[model samples]
Structure formats: C-alpha cells, structure tokens
Target: MPRNDAPDDQAPVASSPPTRLALIVRGGWEGHHPVAATELFLPVLRESGFEIRIEESPDVYADAGVMRDVDLVVQCMTMSEISREAVFGLRDAVAAGTGLAGWHGGIADSYRGSSDYLQLVGGQFATHPSRAPEDRPGDERDNFLPYRVEISEAGREHPITAGVGDFELTTEQYWVLHDDLIDVLATTTHPVQPYHPWHRPIVSPAVWTRHWGEGRIFVATPGHTPEVLEQAPVRTIIERGLLWAARTPSE
Candidate 1:
C-alpha cells in the first residue's frame, strides 16, 4: 500500500558541497622538516580543491573565528608548547565539527604539557628507539632501522587504505601511547633490541582515526623524514588519510 513516487510537497535534497578550506600549521623541532614535509602534499591538496593556509606558529589555533570556519586543520608541529588560548580554541573548534589530522611528531608528540591536546589527538609519542652501533658507542646519528608495516583487516577495507598493501620502510618505528577508542588502520611490530625494554614483538598503531565530539582525528606515525614520505605507500596513506580526516568525499 506504499506509493512508488515521492509526494509533490517534498523538496529535493541538495548534494554536499566540496571541501573549501584547510589550514596547515607547521613548526616546532626542525628535525622532522615540518615545513618541507607539509609542502610535499600542497599540490595534491590544491588539486583536490582546497584553499590551503600555511602557518609556522601555533598561535593560529588561538584564532577562534578562523578556526570555527576552516573545514580542516593539519598540524605539523613537534614537541612544542601551545598557549592556553590556542589550545582551548583548537579544542572547541574541532569539537564543533572541524576535522584535525597530522603525521609523525606533529600531532602525537606535540604539546607534551597539555593533556587536553593529547585527548583530542588520541595518542602520544613515548619514544623512537634507535639502533645504536656497537663499534661507535658515542656516535648515535643513524638510529633509524628498516621495518614492516602491516595493514589491519579493517584497514584493508577502509577508503584510506584502499589499494595499499603491507609495505616496508627504513624509518623510526614509533612507540605510541594511544587511546582505546582509536580505530587502528595499520600497525608495526617493534623488534627486540638492546635499546628497548620490550623483548618480545610489541605492536603499535601506525595509522588510526578517533572521534572527538563531532570532529574526526587522523594520525599517521611513520614520517620521520622527507625520504620516508616519498615512499609510495606512505604517500598514498597520508594523502588518503588527509582527505578522510577532512570529511571530504573520496572517489
């Protein structure tokens, strides 16, 4: 007894508009090459129809009006302290539907003094254990090692991980303290080493997403240097993750 057609009084639904604005806040420890790392994705973001705004300071987070209007915020700061005003502004903005996304130490390791920031990020960087050379006890420059990143079953089906297979890379395998609510997409296992406490294979999330109020949070932990970001899988994951976090429609 149901009619096949819609009633004449019903109005047509409108399609969601394309993502318009994005803010990239980059600064803090130069070791991560925050500026260069963020620049690598500029082209892709532009091509995807975003008007990007780049900032070298965290003060931008304090701009409540600007924060409220931006569709997405991509932070690239590392080990920096955020002002109380900036912290509160950012927290409130994201809670009100502005998406937040970042990679490496930018989101995870930043603002060690702020628990509110950490709660929004859903994780914290504990340590990046390096392979110390036995011959050179004092020289510890090259601490990075090659490791494999395995995609989770959920990731294999997710839009961000589409066409992405498990990949290997020579970089810092981050040991992160993460929230229980995070939906883990991929992970890496830490090998037993003299520098680390875990003797057995300890797995950690390499990519994940968490929800804070109405906003979405995305984090990818593999980018320690620019070379790491050049890897096909790493680049793909980051690009996709950025779009996903921004609430953009992904084809």
Candidate 2:
C-alpha cells in the first residue's frame, strides 16, 4: 500500500482530480441497519468525486471485470456467507490495488466461515462486555456502557486521527481480536468491573489500518447505530478513512 510518490525534481502540474468509482456492498442482519447506515455516507462519497455503485450482495465480488476497475469497496455485509469464487475475486482485486474499508461488523464480522477473508481484514469482533444480570435485572441495555476511546501516540501523527483528542461514548464498546500486522491508531479499554469474569482490563483497537499487497484497508470499531455514526468526531474519522482507503491511479 505504498504511495507512488513522484520524484522531488518533477514539475508540478495543475489538473482536475480524476473521477473514481466506489462500490458499496451492503446487506446482512437488520439489527445493524445496513441500509440506513451506508446511506449516511453516500453524499460524502459523491462530494469526494467518486461515481458510486450500490450492491446488496457480495456476489458482485465474483464479477472480475467490475471489481478490477473499482477504486474502492465499502462493504457492510455482516455474518453472511461468501462463495469461494467471490472470495477469490475479492482477494485478487484488493491485492491488485482495490481499497477496502468498513466499520463495525460490516467488514470486521463478515463471512465468518472464510478464513482468507478474515485474514485479509486483519481483525474480527469478539464480544461487547455486558453488565451482570443483577446490575440491571433483565434489561438488554447492559452492553451500553460509558467508555473512553484513547488516541495512541502514533495516532497523533496519522492523518486519520491527528488532532482528535480522546473521546467518551456510551455504546456497545467492541472487544476486537486482531493480528500484529495492523497499525493501531486508537484504542478502548474494557475495565474489570465487579461481577465481570476478566481479572484484568482489556485494551482493544478502536481504529486501525492494514497494508495488503497493493491495497489499503481501514477499520473503525464504532458506528453500532446511526446515532453513533452521526457523532461529529466519529463522522469525521469515518469520512477521512473512506478517502484514505481509496486506490490511486498511480498505485
């Protein structure tokens, strides 16, 4: 995912930005509000100068011609199955330089049966710690607890998180299982509360990026609901991430 930087001695040229294509693949559990969630960013994608195409299925991945020309793939499918051909097409496209980006379970928790797909994204949603039954007595709201999302030192310099200070939110704070290949930008700590099984606090990556072959991958663990995605900071970060994960012609 290295940028093809031009030589320092190259002359600067003034030209309009090229129009790029963005493929939005969204569908899965209704609880995630996939349609409404992805629609939140349609205008932003257009404003960013991308010609967008919408797909409610991952089957589009099997269309090699379409995938080969896409500049970015914004997936929102969760807990769904993908065919072997589709998976290979997706992997090849990304490796050949098609950017992939998503938030929450859309990209992170998708295609559970596909090991290769899981490995490409570099992370998966584990569980969101919930309050003990005694704490709220039969209420499902136990999972929504206040937590702080802290920006790491490296985040201070990354374009996606620079100048964004630590923020607090009362939502489904995800506990993600990830690999060492990802460059972590921000994190959230799950404190050991009374009645909780874990003996010590657990720190999970809140935001991260991965470089796979010639492509860039971006994931943010927030955006459980449309309300969370509407938050000022959250919206800004996700918008920047979509742009950052797009493939450039030079690449």
Candidate 3:
C-alpha cells in the first residue's frame, strides 16, 4: 500500500467497456423476413460485444426516447410505421453522435410514404417484388438467386471490407435509387427482368456506408431471408459494418 506510483512508460489508459447497443429489431411483413433475419444477426452482434435490445413488438417505435444513451443502433424493423416525432428523435440522436445502421428493405425500402425519413437516410427503395418474366415466383414471395456483387471504389479500403473479398450469394438482389454521395461497399446488377415492364437495366446497391455528423451509418440490401446473411460476403460486410458504424472513421 505504500508504493504509490503511475508508470509513465506503461501504455495509456484504455477507454471504458462497450455498453448496451440499442438494437431496434422490430418485425413485419414476411416479404422482408423480419423475425428470422433479426435472430440471425443478433448472435453476430453479440460476438462483436453488443448487448442487444430487441423490439419484436411494434410498440418500441412508439417511444421516442428509445434511442437515448445507446452506444449504437442496429435496426432490423421492416415495413412498419413510426410517428414523425420518433423518426426525428432517432435522427437527431444519430446526428448528435449516436450510431445508426441497418440492412436491405428494413432501412432503405422502409417507410415508403415518408419523404422526410428518406432525406435523413440518404436513399429509399424505389421498387422491388419483380421477377424475370419467364421466371415466375412460383406462388412464393422470396426470390432467391445467385448474384455477383462488385465492391465500390471508396469501400475498398474501409475496415468492413478489409479482408472481405468480392463474393457471390443466392438471395433477393435489392434494386434501389442509386446515389453518388454514398460510399458504396458492394453492388448487384439487375438486368431488366422479363417481368419488369420498365425497359431500364438496374445496377442495385447492396452494401454501403456513410458519415452523419459525429455518427456513422451502414446499409445492406441482401438479407431477404434468414439464410441470406450466411453467405461469406454478406456476413463479413455486416461484421465489419457494426464495428465501423459504432465508432468514428479515422481522419
């Protein structure tokens, strides 16, 4: 007890342990695999050292304060309605330095009628539920197919893709409004399917990350099913994304 000394040669003090991450994983529409996909991601998030707070009930969105004090937010809610105040609350929190992230329709295709939400999120789901003319969905909603994704220019050096090489998977390739501002992490090209009445070939964005003030954001359009994430490329992207989104990008 008499020896009182601080070692100057020792390493600097480490920060506090990571706290609970408010994982707002709400569920809706089988078209998006809400429950199944959320379950698949929870374990991975925990392995990344997060204490998940799931919101299987839609009521979670009713509480505007749900975003408070959370280290990060991993939203898995799909096709659900939230009060305008709730969106603003979460948006403000993120802009004020809280982390926000999600995948696929849960974030992009979500809140189809809310333009305010779209502005805050950067992109929105323009269209989907399409088929390849001769390729009928066979009375099924989920359309799984093999696809190749090309990582974007800015995304190559990000930690999320550090060791994650370009890869392929069989799942719903999300078609969305292409944006130039986003640091796209990966992409999937959807040639005008025979069933799609539109005559434009679509190059859909599958994974992306962005900066929001002191916060970070990530979006992926691949988890159309619980199994969609098991694909190597998909899993690595999310694994690194959670870590990256929870912290600031190096300057």
Candidate 2: global Cα-lDDT? 0.90
The top-ranked prediction according to TM-score is 2
Model 1, total clashes: 0
| Candidate 3, run of 10 with poorest lDDT | 57-66
Report the number of the highest-lDDT candidate. 2
RMSD per candidate (Å) reads: 5.1, 6.9, 4.2
Estimated TM-score for each candidate = 0.88, 0.91, 0.82
Evaluation by TM-score, superior candidate among 1 and 2: 2
lDDT for 119 in candidate 3 is: 68
* 1 or 3, greater by lDDT: 1
In model 3, the Cα lDDT at residue 188 comes to: 77
Worst 10 residues of 1 by lDDT: 134-143
TM-score of 3: 0.82
| lDDT values, one for every candidate | 0.86, 0.90, 0.70
Q: Give every collision pair in model 3.
A: 104-220, 133-195
